[model samples]
Target: MALDSYDLYVVIILVVAVAAYFAKNQFISKPESTGFLSNDSNGGTNSRNILETLQKNNKNALLVYGSQTGTAEDYSNKMSRELSSRFGLKTMVADFADYDWDNFGDIKDDILVFFILATYGEGEPTDNAIEFIEFLDNEADTLSSLRFTVFGLGNSTYEFYNAIGRKVDLKLEEKGAERFAEYGEGDDGKGTLDEDFLSWKDGVFDSLRNNLNFEEKELKYEPSLKIIERDELTTEDKQVSLGEPNKKYINTSVGTDLSKGPFDHTHPYLAPITKIKELFNSKERSCVHVEFDISDSNLKYSTGDHLAVWPQNSNENIEIFLKAFDLNDKKDNVIELKALDSTYHIPFPTPITYEAIIRHHLEISGPVSRQFFLSIAAFAPNEETKTKLTKIANDKSKYAEEITLKKYNIADALLYLSSGEPWTKVPFEFLIENIQHLTPRYYSISSSSMREKSNINITAVVESEIEKDKRIVSGVVTNLLKDIEINKNKSGDKPLVTYDLKGPRSKFENFKLPVHVRRSTFKLPSSSKTPIILVGPGTGVAPLRGFIRERITQLENDVNVGPSLLFYGCRNENEDYLYKDEWKEYSKKLGENFEIVTAFSRADPSKKVYVQHKILENSAKINEFINNGAIIYVCGDAAHMARDVQQAFIKIISNERKIDLEKAADLVRSLKVQNRYQEDVW
Candidate 1:
């Protein structure tokens, strides 16, 4: 129909353009999409099918981890590497959310599976493991030949400690899976998780050798990853990840608006810190009340939700880690990482620099594991260093005295062991494999969502402890927050530690932090008419503040709010009492409906008074509230304070009701069953 040559040429060009667009959309190859900077899978074709994945990789052992805060995943990786290196087993680490469990029972009898699961709050499965738990509970096939082992990571402070892990082990056995080793539980409450894991791992290895006929081979240094220097690339290269969380950030324009929807643990929004203030008056300690602006983002949080703040390692710690590994000179040099095993995945995005990996990826500030010492001993600079590392790794008391008690990180331990000599012989791949990826820190939201729908508030106490050797042990996120407060306010207070507040490419220049909200079951009653009792001490009062604020909002709205009682404790009235003035204002608004009882632990030097003591002192009132159908909420230190408070309540109930201790405990259990008693302890 085209009569003229010019018209025909234009028509052909348009036709080719349309064809190219369709081709790019349907046929052109693209990099596989992954969870934000995650390397959980190797991008294999059979990644979604557990049985097919194992068969395709020819793996004899599979380790599946259900992790909420990366600990379980870290342990799974460690075990996987040890299995491959020490026993010549073909092992693969799998995330619970990555694969389908429908065909899990179809795996061969030769392969052994290990479940490294962590129990989340209130004995619930982790976010990633919920589906897998449901599948095991509701739909599963029996396979008498399948063999497995389970090790649970939990805090003993919770009533249902290791509940998920125990359930998984029991379910597997009920589904006709053979148990190759005894179930193991690691207690974080006692600060003995590492030792417990090591002890259980030794027993598992023994069982493998004795029963499974797996020979224990001499441990050899076999790197699972290959690191290549990307000399052609620079920090300015768009392909490089200079602490950018994911490829999207690296590819997007600097001025692009990225704070959009679907923000979660993997993808976080960079929210600006709109307000910051010091909450404590003590020189020795510092607590900060900080607020974040999320009006421009799609992030929403309830009053009792948690905010996960992703923090970067301090520049000092990053430099020390690089120097220890002899990577200081090439801190900014771009490098590409490749996994040696097809089933193994590199933990972070590359081409990244040593500095970025240390600052944004690795947990460089965490304590050095004894197993790490044993793993890297083969690459020690000298025989003396190797022997010392081996001895410490084997001896519990010596390891605790030298490493645990001193709180020495990898860099500090290396420097001390080598007498200030850098560990130049250690492979960078080994370090990546041994150290865990940095996880986000969670804080209770201290602001009511109804009052401030778009602004999230959190209160935290900056943690800094001096070891016996005068080495300062600082909390990673808290100190980062402290530095942010100092920098933002332009205050005269000297920061205990410094951080690169500007962030990568100056994206976080104006007091911005990467944050995501995690929904929690810890919440107030559905109706404002339900009476409540809040027990919080120190930073534990964070959520209690939110509860009070919610009631205040309801009252302001002329809603019939119920009576509320709060038990607050601190070191002293003039020192570390958090939100002291705010309480007075809240009292004015709520009037007789709200009451606060204070306990100053250090007010009297001879005796240490705490919130539990105050609870006992107000036994009559507490008993009355209980009788009036008041819900009790406890938030604070789970190791001691929360436990003591619960005991005091039990004592009050026993005295008030003229019941035996067992009967009072049973009543408390019944309350918990009815969701009248809740705890948000750490």
Candidate 2:
């Protein structure tokens, strides 16, 4: 109370020093705690417009995506939503396509960039994301101030699996961008994309909370669907919108690159199925002969080509899928799809019914993966069922025994594992989000383009098998073809069960099936009179048939036809040897120029023989044909028969020329390089 003025001043200085220290720590300091950095309201600027607002409010975020088929776009959207919903941060999903590097270096250091990249086509950049990748390769200095995280989607079967996403992660790190959380890669081949993504996003959110000093919010699924009911129509007519899409969007530009075109998983060309016939009377396997007419179309293909068939979801399976998703009542609801790329289109009738989506869009043929089992496990009706699902998801051996190895599709697997409780509680969006789109099945083009410019022929053995556990699995496209053939034979007397081969969208309706030409390297010699040898088994004789037809047509025009030798085989000659009548016509014109040797493994009980055995039997003539510069072609099973035939050729060359095995193998390799030895095997 009686203190002097000097004592009072000393007390004031101490108080001022404490206040300055507290203010500095609160405003300008970094926290020691590790996790998602808290949002710096002042530094996290997003775009130019966001930056102006940020100068007033705070910083913003950046959304980046490297999508293979638009899945990453969906994920990026999800991330943007989470950033806004949980952190109260302003966010916008940016396509890597539209991003520029001019001011990237000048961006605030606290700006968050989220990357959702999907690996594709042996780790090659996706068509839409390629431009962005090029920018990254050149603009290392621009990203030095940025903070980012990456999640890659990929299949493991490919050698360079997830290389695109992994490469981007490395490049970003090299450019001095700091990570928000550990950048991760998800394997779609193992079906861990969803789980891996879910776990990674949670870590990212946690990091954001701690590292950025942002407050955490509860995580919840925000419904993206808008449901509307039409009173004029039945209950099935109620439309559900996944997300609002631009209805007036036009598709005017057409893709020119046939090989890498948009004719794969997302969008498929509904090529016509022109001609189909049964090749065998009695066998475990059914040989399907089909010719697709491509004369009026701009599609061009060559011999030794493969036709890609865009298959439909079986009606029964579609119904099952609808029931599973609890969308059975609204099966006919119409919706349009919107994608960032022209190559990625809606995989159905444009603005089509929901039934069309179930029937033609989703891939319902394959076995369900464990990740799917885990995702839906929470929706299980009981605790016991949930535990079982969790176990299956965690244990590969159990999953194999109970799901994959058992070869169970979604419906059957759910029914069996869940004790037949109807799985109608799962959302339609979940199904659409999880299941992959149906892809086209490739068929070897059996007909030579030189012989029939208007028609492209294909030969396929309809695949069907019964699992050990008594589940019937049918090949999707082949069965679709068979059903189409049966309906055509009925002459419209009855309604089709699965399909009308000549469906409404099928433009080549006059022809039996939809087909497009695929260019390939398999072809006959350019010389009209060049001697040739053909070795094919089963329906593999398809292209060789085209070659023979070409020779016959040329001979009819008085062109010189050289010696033609064929070694064909099947289970039995009377059963599965294809094109019996056509071969007769070919023989008539070619005479000694045509040689047909048939090997029927089941025709004789004494011993079984194949085309390779037949070739060995006639080694002398084969050698003569080979020495005369004859082109050799082999078509069949690539994993076995083609390999066996190749080895047999080596043996023949070794013995005939009296050379060692190495020398004989070298000769074969040289012939292959020179195009004298060619193969078209599946």
Predict model 2's lDDT versus the native.
Answer: 0.66
- Considering summed lDDT, which 10 consecutive residues are worst modelled in model 1? 28-37
Query: Any runs in candidate 2 off by more than 4 Å, and if so which?
Result: 1-274, 335-351, 466-471, 491-497, 500-514, 604-606, 618-628, 658-676
TM-score of 1: 0.93
Give the TM-scores of the predictions, in the order they appear. 0.93, 0.64
lDDT of 1 by residue, 169-242 (tens): 99999989999999999999998998899988998999999999898888787878899999999999887888
For 135-213, candidate 2 gives per-residue lDDT tens digits of: 6787546467778888988876544578888998999888778887788888876666766787788799879888888
Error of 1 at 347 (Å): 1.5
Provide the lowest-lDDT 10-residue window in model 2. Answer: 33-42
